[model samples]
Target: MAGYVCPVGSSSPHARSNACPPGTFSNHLHLFDKSQCETCPARFVCTRGTGGKQKPPVPCPVGHYCPPGTKYPAQYKCAPGTWSNRTSLASEEECLPCPAGWFCVAGAHVPSGRCSPGHYCPDGTRTSTQFPCPAGTYSTRLGNGRVEDCIACPVGSYCTDGTSKPTLCPVGTYRKEQGAKVSEDCVPCPGGYHCPELGTVAPQACGAGRFSDPGSASCLSCLVGHYCADEITSREAMLLAMVCPAGLLCPEGQAVAPDANGNACPRGYYCPRGDIVRGSVWLLLFTILSSSGLCFWEARVESVLLLESLPALGCLIFLLWFP
Candidate 1:
């Protein structure tokens, strides 16, 4: 009696052979030569054997996946941040974390997507690209591609001309009075004190006294006993006032007044004894009253008497004799 061949897909196949392929086997019930089959259809695997004839088809092994475009079984690799395509995969692995201040767009894939350094994307905006920090804003903090925030300069500070942030204009330092062209145009401080002007130079002395140094914008107080009376004039009053003649004194009893010339008594009325204290005012009045020469002779004689006796009585006598 002849034995019936099993189906080709079952464990017990129709044909059998001792010379099976490395990845295939044969069964006992044979209707045709197993070595003659060159290829297997879908859902089956055929192994190479002697002389290009492949082994009989067998079901694919479990836990292995063959996606399109892959030629070899060893080319299979799991993607980052994703699960492997195998049911028997025991452990889940994650991709590397993105570096600080940087953002990763593609996870665990070779040639991963990334954002440029020193840039960020704001909320509601796509994070595929990086945007640079705008003028008037700055940040020292680390960030990813998602950072869109930057710090602003405070009041009294400005970063004109597209600076990263505002810088301070120091105290006592002021900008140019008008028509400043650039930060350098801010003038050096006036005389007495110093400060950084327009973000340069440390503070320094401007000049002496409230009078500012020449060509400077700042000022200082006058030195003791010396006065800066006006924007242009110097208050050297004592020096400017007239010096009395060798023996003459001013009629006001003071050696000096606004004028430098001593206040000598008038011609008709002499300064009694040439004493400024006893007869200055009277002599001034008498000199005006006796302008007609009426008291000229008596004024001379009274002047002689005053020189001998410079008392108030002599001054009264001189006043009485006035013409």
Candidate 2:
């Protein structure tokens, strides 16, 4: 019998063709009987042969299952959001769920890329990119595992929704607070000062002859005889403006800081906008006359004596007016 065989040293009869069972196979061309068939090995799936010599069972692949007797892998693939990095998996339990800060698509052997910049991913994520960082925060690096990892917008900067990094507050504006969610959080430059560049933490004081108002980007120069004093604005109470010596004429920041705010007007002159200029005659007269503490008539007499020391008023006035 071509398709039949019996145990060795058997009796005269009882030989018949019997197929190998499912999940079992044999490749022996000359053998005794069904007892010679081999059971499928671990980490592999097997199917019965065509009642003849048979091939080896299929080995399991990474991220897939290969239970004994399994005819196809479709029934035991790693699900979406789960993955495996090793082969020879015997069951669905061998695949693990994606880890924090990473993602795994269907049948994934390793995590897809890490969470993208400007985004975050929690455990078992299937699409890490779909999760964005919250507003008022930003992420400059990849694989942020939680929302708390995103950085707050720094002083002089702002962050919108899903930002990758904070943006500098625009020029002529400043922000005192951190974690600004919008551009409007930056305040305009204040009066008596200017904001020359982006991300100004504080306004720069205007120099001589220049004045600014609230929300001004830069200082404006005044006309002749019209001095621009920070004192004319909200700084009137007392401005800590800097001024070089009357004739010393030093550059900014090099002016000797006689006081905390830098130099004040030198003797015999006043600095209207923190710059030296000749003192006003009327102002000098007023200071002497008002502060002498003398009676009205006494002050008037003192003023006349001071005036008498000068040249004749008529001729002096003629030259000044004509010139």
Candidate 3:
């Protein structure tokens, strides 16, 4: 006889709201209501049971599993910290750590990928292995891409990773302070001093009376007859007042005296002033005195002859003036 189906949850015949259709509830239909069903506890799938259930036994979906505890409606999830390449029909294994120099950002789900070049993480975020240090710079310490690893200037020179050593001024040059890592820091020779070569040493002075010019190898002497007053004070000043004053002839008799400028004439020489005639006369007397007796005798004969030759010569002789 035709009959009504059964209702959920009631064990009595009243639970059937209607008679089962030929195909309906033919499989394991253990639970009267679909709502009462649950997925297997995490690694097991549903299987046919004694009762006629809404669905036949089924396997878990790919990448996922149905655990043992429940039967139908719900699906189970993978265990925490565990993963599988494809859907899992069984329990999952724990994920492994990424290899060195690599990172696994998504934990169990994603694969490890290479770290970016110029950057490294030996132990994930805990340590770093930065790229190579630049030329002229070094990092004996760890380089985590931070500023601390960069080198700095030493006592006498400076830099900001711009160059290796604090630039050494060439041999004959100097810098005021440290951190000068370039040629620009090398200063020129000091006043009155000179340095043909460039470098870190203080400029040498063209000592007293010497003239030191820039770019020259050594100091030069002041011209003759000129004095180098305050010679040591300034070399360029050597040119000043270097000439002898006019009228103050650098006398021939005496070595030319280096005026107030420090000029020194040879000894036995005197620079006299006024008419050269008087000077000539004095020079003549000196010449005569220095001559031999024969020269004196000859000079005497000439004078006597001239006196006899003229009447005026007689007048001049009485005046004690004989030419």
Candidate 4:
């Protein structure tokens, strides 16, 4: 017999014969030697080999794989990122890959858990923390599986790597774009305004006679006449600006009100606006009145006056410009 035991059973007429046991296998033809049958190796199992090749067993099981044969009834575990829910698994292929948005450990039967917030875990990942939201990005939800799940930093704010919240842009700065990765992305506020608080999307307008250069830290008071009337862009809206009306000590950023008359013009000079200064008109008028012998130009002029029409004052004052 190829695999059967000495079926003749000691060659006695009364002796009985039987098939080979489940654990042993024999592969010879016409072999009656009892020693020919061999014990099965660990890598394979032998059973019901009456006269020829051994029968193949069913798949080992679902969860546990074939053991190294170190002992009986023992099983091996699946690798990381792969899992099995039952016992006696046949091969490594029997294990399932980790699902999306989740992770599996080396011996996990099901996914260990969902990916955490601010982190990501793609299908087949071995750990929950395999990836983190990168710099300039953030996430607030769990079970995120890809880099795309992380959102870009928002306008008027900044975000660091793996951040979950955005930080507001500081005062004196502003951001206009949808995604501002770092604090440096916040730009300086434009000129003529001031930023007064912690976060500023738009700067506050400076007070009249006050100005800020590109949202500087503080507002600077304007000196009267120091700012050119024709200049634009660099100038603040003079919404409440006041000009010294006539005959009072009024400087640029006047904080006090005019109360009474001040200095008057001398014969050779004239007072206009708030200054005592002489121009071509004063010289021309003085010569004309002196030659006419009228000398009527002399009057009890009290203070510098801003008049709509100075000629109405009867030569007491001469205005070169009305605008």
Which candidate, 3 or 4, has the higher TM-score?
4
Measured by C-alpha RMSD in angstroms, how accurate is candidate 3? 21.6
Model 2, position 71: C-alpha lDDT score: 53
Q: Which model scores highest in TM-score? A: 2
**Looking at candidate 2, what is the lDDT of residue 15?**
38
What local lDDT score does residue 186 receive in model 1, on the 0 to 100 scale?
Answer: 43
lDDT of each structure? 0.35, 0.60, 0.38, 0.56
Which lDDT value does model 1 have at 45? 45
Query: lDDT per residue, candidate 2, 1-323, as tens digits?
Result: 22223567755322333545556656555556766666656577555451343346667677777776565445467877789988778877888988889878878889877988888878778886767887788898889888898888788888888889788888878888888888898888777677777888887887655666666667665422233444333233123344332322233223123442444334443333333232322221221233343321111111111221222222111111111
Q: What is the C-alpha RMSD of each candidate to the true structure, in Å?
A: 21.5, 15.0, 21.6, 14.6
On residues 25-141, what C-alpha lDDT tens digit does candidate 4 reach at each position? 566655565467666444444454533544433233443455332122224556777777766555677788888789888767778888887777787888777787887788888
Candidate 4 — which pairs collide?
Answer: 61-88, 63-86, 64-89, 224-252
TM-score per candidate: 0.26, 0.50, 0.33, 0.48
The candidates, ranked best first by TM-score, are 2, 4, 3, 1
lDDT per residue for candidate 3 within 59-133, as digits (tens), equals 455434544543442344433323334433554342333344544443234433444433433433222323332
Where does candidate 3 stray beyond 4 Å?
A: 1-161, 196-198, 215-217, 223-226, 229-235, 241-323
Q: Give residue 319's error in model 4 in angstroms.
A: 40
Lowest-lDDT window of 10 residues in candidate 3?
A: 302-311
**Residue 80 lDDT (model 1):** 27
